[model samples]
Target: MEQIFKWLLTVSGGVIAFLFGAWTPMLNILVALMVIDYLSGMAAASMNGELKSRVGLMGIARKVFIFAMVAVSHLVDLLLIENKIEVGYLAMSVVITAYCLNEVLSIVENAGKMGVYVPETLTKAIAVLRSKPQKEEEKPVAPSTLEVPAVVAPNPPIVTAEVKKEEKEEIK
Candidate 1:
């Protein structure tokens, strides 16, 4: 049984590596972004009382569609290589990059819809996706990492010896 499981896993991994290129950081980021987008969408929808089973399934289908696009692009890239075209994964890279930016934008929108304050950097990603300006040269920044804001009390309560003593007596 263990051997069978290992064989299945190996076959599955091989198929995936072929359908998509060997797993790389870029692909990993794309997948992570997709998951975040989907979860955020659901959260935002529930917050708005707009959650529905049908819609949720549709979202899953859309994510699968994105994966299908990636796979098709990879297949095209493979075909090009077979023909000695030597495009070097250009099609696959383009599909993945486009989807990555799209996922980033969707996540930001989902956050906004959920009444979350999107970090400035993430908002800029939308602009970078839409278009860019050549006004000034600046160092390129990586995509913004999501961080849930921590809740802090407006004013922390102070503990005093008198309060502690009174509370102890009340407990008795």
Candidate 2:
């Protein structure tokens, strides 16, 4: 048990070091938003009966890809400008703008799952975000038919399957 605990701690420490080693406030904020968005999305997906590990992992991959894109954009900016301030601002602008939009969208999506209707401003924002890339049109579609399982609490942010069979089906 002690060995297991030590191993877990070492792994956790390594992960933290790797992820935050390049930490800027902007990167920190983005990471926080990413985590919140992932969790909230998982909750919403569960509520809609669309939760799958494969889908969740794909979401994570996409999120990471956004950061990679931002990095590439920064590289381009660096090559173009002699002013470090200009390059920093350009990179920060690209990354922060994308993360801010993503966080707001996640909040609205989670609220929608909780049965809270979004305000028009938020809806418009979401629409704008959706218009970003042509691939945005492939956004995940919520199922038209979903039921609150008897075992799941009415107030749960995520819906839970009542039976093992349903859980198995969901995993598949």
Candidate 3:
């Protein structure tokens, strides 16, 4: 038992050392953003009365896919024979930026839903991060004017003089 415990401790220490040596501030920021986004989504769902444990679990599963996508991007860059370090950093930066923006926006939106009065500056920042510009409503579209063709009636048969005489004889 003692031997097993020592081995486990050694392995855990080795893993921790590796992580600390390879860790970047950007990676930490990305993780923070991911957590915040998840929590904000949960809060928004609760506020909307649509919270479901199974759905939230699925949301988390989808969120985890972002990291897998980033990993795939890094692999692609390596396959392209680019500088692996620069490519990885660039990919991580972009993914982290997008995730951080999404999380912050979600948090702000949830706060708004909860009736919290956010500052105008913050709102503007969120809008810029989301890349949604305010716009005025435009004129409505005119309805199409294509006319439907009318149905034609079948021609009536003409009454002949012979047929009228036959009818008179029958009546007599």
Candidate 4:
């Protein structure tokens, strides 16, 4: 049993090394944030009675995709170096930073939804990071000042109780 455990540990270590190069501090923090986000999302969903198997599966898939993208970014870094280009790990760093921020935002949102008190400053920071500046041409137009015509429908004929009673008597 000890032998099997050792083998499993060795394989897992090798896989992590190959994927992340050296298990840097930033990578570790990103992984932790991803896990926290997922768990918090599940807790929030459970609390809100909104848990669904399909949605959970999709969430897992999305987490996997995030790592896949990071790996791709690392590959891009390696490719640049291999081709004699002097680019460093900038691509990987940018990709990882973006994903980490995204995960942090998601975790905060989940925590907030679960009735946790998230700090206003952190929320504002996230909003600023995620927001994109809009051009003047892209800005939404204000409400129109023009007046609109109202459609008036004719009233329907009214039937009284006495008329109904007379009609019933005639039928009798």
List lDDT for all candidates, in order. 0.91, 0.73, 0.72, 0.87
Q: For this target, which candidate reaches the highest lDDT against the unseen true structure? A: 1
- The stretch of ten residues in a row with the least summed lDDT in candidate 2 is 15-24
Tens digits of per-residue lDDT for model 4, 1-172: 9999999999999986777677778888898998999899999999999999899999999999988898888888888999998778888889999998888889988988899999999879877877898676755656695567888668967899999999999999
User: TM-score order of candidates, best first?
Assistant: 1, 4, 2, 3
Better of 2 and 4 by lDDT: 4
lDDT winner, 3 or 4: 4
User: Candidate 2: where is the Cα deviation over 4 Å?
Assistant: 1-22, 82-87, 128-172
lDDT of 2 at 14: 77
The clash count for each model shown is: 0, 0, 0, 0
For model 4, how big is the CA root-mean-square deviation?
19.1
Q: lDDT tens digits, residues 1-172, model 3?
A: 9999999999988764443334567667777877877787788788889899999899788777766665554455555545444544455457667766676788787777766799989888877777866697886665575566888768878899999999999999
Encode model 2's per-residue lDDT on 1-172: one tens digit a residue: 9999999999988764443334568777777888888888898888889899999999989888877766665556656665544544475467667776778687787877867788888778777877756554555657775565668566756555567678888899
lDDT of prediction 2: 0.73
| Error in Å for residue 126 of model 3 | 4.3
TM-score of 3: 0.53
Each candidate's TM vs. the true structure? 0.67, 0.54, 0.53, 0.65
Return the candidate ranking by lDDT, descending.
1, 4, 2, 3
